[model samples]
Target: MAFSTIKDSITFHPLGDAAIVIQAGADIREEIHERVKQLFTCIEQHPFDGFVEAVQAFTNVTVFYEPYTVHQAAHLQTHNLSPYEWVKGYIEGLLEEKWQGGGQVKRRIVDIPVCYGGALGPDLEEVARINGLTSEEVVRIHTKGTYLVYMIGFAPGFPFLGGLTEKIAAPRRETPRMSIPKGSVGIAGKQTGVYPISTPGGWQLIGQTPLPLFRPNENVPSLLRAGDEVRFVQMSEKEFFSMKEAER
Candidate 1:
């Protein structure tokens, strides 16, 4: 089916029976991400009869709704439309209204302290070699850039961060690690992320953060969220150990 485009380069597509994806653009950019977040806020504030929740990503927002609630809505009864159609129209209306009141939400700045190289970052040197850089230069490049949390997926609190400069960009390991330590900072291609929990992964290990990215005990388990700004602060091995010990 041909996709429909709206103002601000937005597009809509139905997802199965109960969800619809609203895309801002074809590429990943900060402006496109801002549009996605704006749409997310619009849907959250002005929900239709069957609205469930809106999930944000790099260039789109996936809105989930309860089909039954939509189908039974008195206003929708006269339209003789399916749930998907009703929801699509509703979102279209929102888009036409310029994503009402979704103006520039304040972004949170999150600082992640890391100890780069040595035991914690086993693949640090490998990454440096791949990029024709020294381990110190790689660390300097990484800590200097500010990253954006484009989305939270793969694992709980695992933030897919953007804004990795080409200077330090490295490919994933040829072989996946059997088990990665929790809070390990790794780079896969143009992206960088921290392992929220111990799991198998292929990203080149570059550092380890002493802070816990995932905390199940908290009401909001994930330490980070989409739209947050991230900055990496370099710490010494001694400081890393001290912080880790304090967490325990």
Candidate 2:
């Protein structure tokens, strides 16, 4: 679907009974992502009486709320609407209002050093074969492009990044690995992402970074978040190990 069409008529749908989804676009584009982040920021800054939290996704924002509090809101009693409807109306109002401080979001740039090929990137050869390119070319192309974090999902601090060039695009493996090491950078279709924690995945592994994406003890647990830009810098095995040891 065209982004302009979706932008003209933003959809509002209920997620079960406690949450509502505000769809900003039909496809994943930076403009659509900007709209989603803008709405997310607006909602986070100006929450309703029952608002809990809002999660930003590639094309929409899912808002969670306390249903009982919404139902008990004295102001909403006159409308005789359900909690979802009340929240929807509130968000619709927000859409019409000028965003106070959401004109632009501060995008953070994070450079992650990666060791490509060898034991760290077991599927590197496979990815090169699939794309009809040499392993060195794959690394060159992958590192040259900057990626945008559309959202964090599947695992804690796992960023679903966009901006992967079609030249090195590779499909997911037919069978997913039982456990992919944390910080493994992989490509699936047109997207690339890092496994923040050790987990099962099927993306074509091309490299691995030594950085810790998830920090359980920190106030902000995720090293990366939605709207951040990631740059991959190639490193040698010796450097990777040195950095890994330094991290330890």
Kindly report which residue stretches of model 2 are placed more than 4 angstroms away from their true locations once superposed: 1-7, 100-105
- State the lDDT of candidate 1 residue by residue for 2-83, as single tens digits: 1234364777788988899987888888877877777787788898887888998888899999998989983667888888
lDDT of 2 by residue, 1-248 (tens): 33343446589999999999998878999988888887788888888888999999899999999998998873667778989998998887776674543355779999999999999999988888988999999999999999999999999999999999999999999999999999999999999999989999999998999999999999999999899999999999999999999998
Per-model lDDT? 0.88, 0.90
RMSD of 1: 3.3
Question: What's the lDDT for residue 190 in model 2?
Answer: 99
**Residue 18 in model 2: lDDT:** 98
TM-score of each: 0.92, 0.93
lDDT of 2: 0.90
Q: For candidate 1, give the lDDT of residue 148.
A: 94
lDDT of 2 at 154: 91
